[model samples]
Target chain A: MSRPKRQLMMGNQACVQGALRAGLRFYAGYPITPSTEVTEGCARELPKTGGRFLQMEDEIGAISAVVGASVAGVKAMTATSGPGYSLMVENIGYAYMIEAPCVIVNVQRGGPSTGLPTKTSQSDTMQTRWGPHGDYTAIAVAPSTVADTVTETIRAFNLAERFRTPVTILLDEVIGHMQEMISLPEPGEYQVVDRVKPTCPPEEYEPYGSTDNFVNPMPAYGDGYRWYATGLTHDAMGFPTNRPDEIVVNLDKLRRKIEDFRDEICKVRADWMDDAEFALVSYGSVSRTALLATKLAREAGVKVGCLQLQTVWPFPLAQLRELLQDCTAVIVAELNMGQIVREVERVAPPQARVHSLLRYDGEILTPIQFLEKIEEVRS
Target chain B: MTTTAESVAEQRRSDVHLSYLRPHKKFPNLWCPGCGNGIVMSSLVRAIDKLGLPRDEVALVSGIGCSSRMPVYLDFQALHTTHGRALAFATGVKFARPDLKVIVITGDGDALSIGGNHLIHACRRNIDITTILINNYIYGMTGGQVSPTTPSGAYATTTPFGNTEKHFEPCDLAKGAGATFVARTTVYHTPQMDRVLADAIAHHGFSFVEVLSNCHTYFGRLNRLGSATALLQMFKEKTTSVGKTEESANGKIPIGVLHRDLETTELCDEYQKIVDSLSKGKQG
Candidate 1:
């Protein structure tokens, strides 16, 4: 392996680098603040590698194009902020229905409707899983630091291709714009997964045929296996169908592909959790503050630890319950109006106390504020 | 032993069917009987047959509409995407695999009302994809709602009082949006529709063909336009050749290729040029 090189880079720029390393060859996106850098980086760099980048008319078109490219046998991605993410909900659902593998990055800004373009928020945590209407499984990952952003983006694409589903990377404005020194991974340092292709001849190939693992072999367009793909509920042949049995089988495949492989799909980082009274749960940028807060709390003789979630969706419930079993209380710190805190409360042991430390006023949660919340919850 | 004109025409029709259509998918299509969409589909299939292009190399993409269902009956790499997003998806397919012939089949509302942004932008980019927009003047699949192409004073379910919105001239809109090739034809004129679709598919840049199809189940019944056959006959009488520049009496609509620009660079080619220069610059 080549030596890793240390470079100063923005988190968004690192994401672009990670995408390139993960075999992404097509990028389609529109400019949205806090995430525009990702698009700009791809535009400048993708062509040099013989990959293509398109600045579509809107977020909807951007994601639609990404889905198309993915179906056409290219690893594809798009980046957007809150407003743009909202616009992409329908096509995201379409991707899920059609089982297209692509990565979507939401560098979240505060929003009900373009609420804060330049400020940071983790308000889209729930949106990442539930934004698209219907019964389907979703995978979203969060990265707290610039280095983690690259690694997590690579993981996102791998999971997307392996599972044949859309994967989202949730970044806040803080993580997106913050500059940090990071050691870029050498080639082969991380795993890269491409979708499985069909071994059968063109006549016998089924695009959505089920295997022992839920994912079917995906044939690229013009691969002589010219099968159908649709957003409508479809059969194993990828043709639209309204039959109850076929619909149930199709929807069940989508859910089970990720759910059954939760252990392999979910990633979390634990700090000082072996012997602790208070456990702090956080993700994305807030995890940085939580880490500092845990350090300060330990300095003050308050036995506290942090659980930094890297994979936000697939919930990682089993892991959370196991880790929080010995702790007396768990504090969920996030830069939103208590989104993932509810998940913490739902999964924590019956004896463990659950409290939320939320900051939705367009400001990052400081370590001091986290300490105060810990004190309040402890008392 | 001589063949009559009718017999020769019948023989050609069967040949086109055998060559272009999927044999296993039997005849009664999803469209309502006498729906002009079937005629448009046949014309499209005939166009492909005439070009002698490999079926496996072509991709048919569509959004949700009665007209959009045309792809399931034919044999090609097909994508039935979300409502009103066929062009956007088709853009991706074309960009990724420029060698594959991508054709989009969309209807009035699917192309104009909800998917209008993608339509105009696709035209502006002049991407190398053939788009056949079937303008039935109303939303048929949704049961006769007024659409952007529904003529003013025409009646639809949503426009029971009368449609107050002016209809769009699709060919003009495509030309204004920078489509390299634009044309208009009626489903009644089968030979013209087939010829125009072939030319559009053969164009090296973005091409648009607006087929004035009849939604006999919705638009016709609402407007009291008689039977589907009567409406088709009306199309033949009320439309003038685009070559006849003089306005026919009673405001006859023009039918035929309205615009063509063979010199404009296609989007895919332009993108490739950028990639080439960037790669060369890196090496030098």
Candidate 2:
């Protein structure tokens, strides 16, 4: 039977392959629904690559360990579901505040608390933006297909390394478990990114101070530049302090470093939007439904387009405002109760009405749901 | 092969900070005055110095507490992480780079209360790292809350009327959790503290040190030892040799190297071995 052609894999499995391709050497995570496959996939594959895999006792431990591995100079990652992601917020902030590069894959499930293990939900979209306490910037990507999981996972790591912050590859359980045919090129095809390292002598290195940017090139723990790191609002030297001016400077730098370069980091896919009167805004698995609805709307003699978000954070506000310019109205469809719809409403022109089609029940949004919401909003 | 604590201390004082430590002292160290956290920090720096570990190769992971501030003072790569998860982070750090020396510095409240799960598992897995737990008998940073090591009748901010809970002997707990090397020492005993700290760092597998530190400002005030000198004297009188048999440990808790044995199973070593075997099998 030729071994079934050797290329078909599940989205979770694709994530593991992508992580390996990205040179992820350590994974510490707790198994939760939908996201369990990620840990299982890593457990099955990490042994072949001489990488380390550990089932941490909880989500906090999982992300904390990933941050630690990054500081020690290894590409590291952790995976989790809704509750687990919520538990990981503080440490995620720590990673951003300290400029520790790592990746987190949140295979999102139904929310508030242990809502549903096997089902899918996009409830975490806003949580991903503001989950962690205190203020910082985040780069979050949502993938629609199993293939996109592979590509976005690689990009997630690249963004993390390039910015020296934690990056999230937001996947819904629907995509996480979806089986599809994907051809993964050999390791050389992907451009893997490792964080830039300091070339200065160990004695001359300032762990948090860089001459060119807010981020200092991080030296691996064993590379000889001993630098202090802390979760507290810190000075450039990595020491904890509550000084108001120092906190303002540190916090502003963390937010500005990523926000200033939003044009380079933010990504969105616009389909047939230039002359359309109506637009559908969505991401992750729901974007698939939006595409189907857009096709149906076109057949019904309605000129509609779809904006599929690849990078969900930094909100892609500029692109979104530009996209919504010509549209008479926009329908924002998601699995949650109006999370991204609020952002759409925030960016869309007042004259261009924006409406939401949201679901909190543990079920995928169907094409019919999107069509119904579009018709209701159009009327 | 012979070394004394005094020799180690002198050498450490002159030794340069690890590559991670910057020129000036990191500001706002959370430790209170006359606190023994400084002693523990010095002991660690001394161990790093004596071992001749390249500064950049040593990573110090710490959780929240007074002693958790150790990483900020000494130069070296550090991840001052959340409360109670330092060991878990150190596990990832050590396993990811087995070539580097990974040290976890945690306080009693931080390691034993919220971080309890990580502590036992790290010991059970025998990961190649050293965990230095500073047991000040109370939560120093959060205002003298009763900790896992608070004596049964001792008073604390959280336990104002006096605690009703039983305390854990961290060394015994670590040994029970399968730590390959477990020892107990006090900041007052500088020579023994230095020696035990060095040995713990040198051990191949997971090594745990329960350092009895004095939080004179909080824990001391509650326990009636208001001064640092008084707490040091108390430590001297209370601690006994672990070499004593079970009969001796029956009434008096032995406080030296309570457990030391090597089954020689390290987490990263076993993981790497599995990788090797799998690769070999694939080749065949």
Candidate 3:
């Protein structure tokens, strides 16, 4: 008498299940195509879980409301597509500087301002990194499958809480709306990280003080500790300052905190790269086609492999360097105008050639299309 | 504990300077001398002190502007965010922890201008939080530009020829937007402001306060109220609190508890109740 085995679910539904499992008690969002399903699923499920769901007036309000909810000390999230993601940049910057822990899901769509609302694109890859002004680092995870969507959403929540930073689940339209069979892991199977709580007396705790761990403990409101947080350059006490050296040191620390612990932050999957002449570098739904293309290429004796990225930002360059060092060339396949391909070219060895296979009209690349690029790059 | 009216008054006069004020005087204070933001900041600190909310459990959020800088001077967890979105950040802060007492100190420019949508929806949704909007009738941070509250005839940087645009009566706006607790007070009216703020904090729903402040440098110079004291005098002269049953007339906006409709449901509580029922369903 086994409990119900794995069930078929849409990528958005899986994300909702992930939010529930991760203890996401609040969700604020505006509905847009491709990403609307995530909001719809949350709307139906959050109330059942005693979790809150709000359809804000617009994307800015949605993210803002989530930020407000976050400070009140609940696990909160919001979902949107590319255009909505653009509107959320200001609040995202606020979350970054204030060290507010929350999750945002962007079901990527073709954009430069609503290029194709219903189409898929990875154009937001660079936007997610540089959309907001000012100096800050972001943590974004790209999921390749419906199972990955669920797990990665949970991981995004955990990473956001642990780091006291906003984390983005970089999904595309193809994966977000795709219906797929996935086994839901038991509730206890995955590690769920909660934000660090203040253990010291309110008088002694500085909101941004760095101990050996480089992360400060956060105290939720009404707990009696009074601390200050601001977007401006501040000292350990969270008061604004104009010191140049202090600004430099604080900015450096913000970057180093993530990079210093890169091993814990980065994630990538490799398949059949031991004796490969060509490698297909891909992420999100595009990684699926690359994997299938690799299987076909290998069967055709082309010796191709796939490097699937899970943590897209802080782009696992070191792992990439080691993985592609011996390969003759790397073909990057994505649903956008070759964003990550540039990153691959930048990080790949000087001797290894880099090529991009882009699809911008809101369509997913099929195995044939990916194999064509791999074969062309190999020749 | 419920706070008493007497204690609220005592809180206002209480020495809150040590907790918030910079140890040494910093120059180039943006507010006009004797402007209400300092008083409002003091009132906020005193209210937090009176309630004895754990400092760490409190996160003060503000958007860009003169009043938004209130977070910078406070000792509590604060986020000085972008223009017009303090409510949004405070929303994030509150939803993330729910245990945290989140306070948003925003201004007319930050709240009603760029942040107007966030403000309206936050009130409508009725989340349990407090928003202190300092209404100085002009954008003080950006050299006293016209704001949503600037009187139609008022002059501002953007309205050099006198504003012909309509002004938003904040108290009415909050009440109409379904805020559970809405109040208005001038900084000169310190006792009432402190008491009302504390009540707003304890109200269990979205609480909004329009602290009619003086923008002597901007709104004042244009409107012929030349000094901060003169502006305070004007606030005293213009405002009169209508008791609970009285209908507020045009040009007679009340100075206290404009509306206190407790019937509106709080979003998180409703959400939690649903979770409780579901978990019970699972157990049964």
TM-score to true structure, per model? 0.97, 0.94, 0.91
Write one digit per residue (lDDT tens) for candidate 3, span A1-379: 5875878899988999998899898898898988998999988888776677777789987887787677666888999998899999988887777788889999988878877888888989999888889887878999989999989999999888888888999999888889888888787789889888999876677777767656778866666665666777777777677899778766766777677777787898999999988889999998988888899989998888889989998788789989999988888888887788888998888888898888887778999888777757755
Scanning candidate 2 chain A in windows of ten residues, the lowest lDDT window is A1-10
Candidate 1 wrong stretches, greater than 4 Å: A1-3, B1-12, B22-27, B247-250
Compared with the true structure, what per-residue lDDT tens digits does model 1 show for residues B127-193? 9999999999999988999999988999999999999889888888899999999999998999999
Note each model's CA RMSD in angstroms: 1.8, 3.4, 4.2
Which is the leading candidate under TM-score? 1
TM-score of chain B of each: 0.94, 0.90, 0.88
* Candidate 2: tens digits of C-alpha lDDT, residues A235-322: 7666766889878888888887788889878899998787888899999998888888888988898899999999999799999998
| Total clashes in model 1, counting residue pairs 3 or more apart in sequence or in different chains | 0
Candidate 3: segments with Cα more than 4 A from true spot: A1-4, B1-12, B16-30, B45-59, B74-77, B93-102, B202-204, B243-254
Find the candidate with the highest lDDT and give its number.
Answer: 1
CAPRI level of candidate 2: medium
lDDT score, candidate 3, position B76: 65
lDDT: the better of candidates 1 and 3 = 1
The DockQ leader among the candidates is: 1
**For model 2, how does the per-residue alpha-carbon lDDT over B128-226 read when each residue is reduced to its tens digit?**
889999988998787889999999989999898999999988888888999999999998888888889889999999999998888899988887876
TM-score of chain A of each: 0.98, 0.96, 0.97
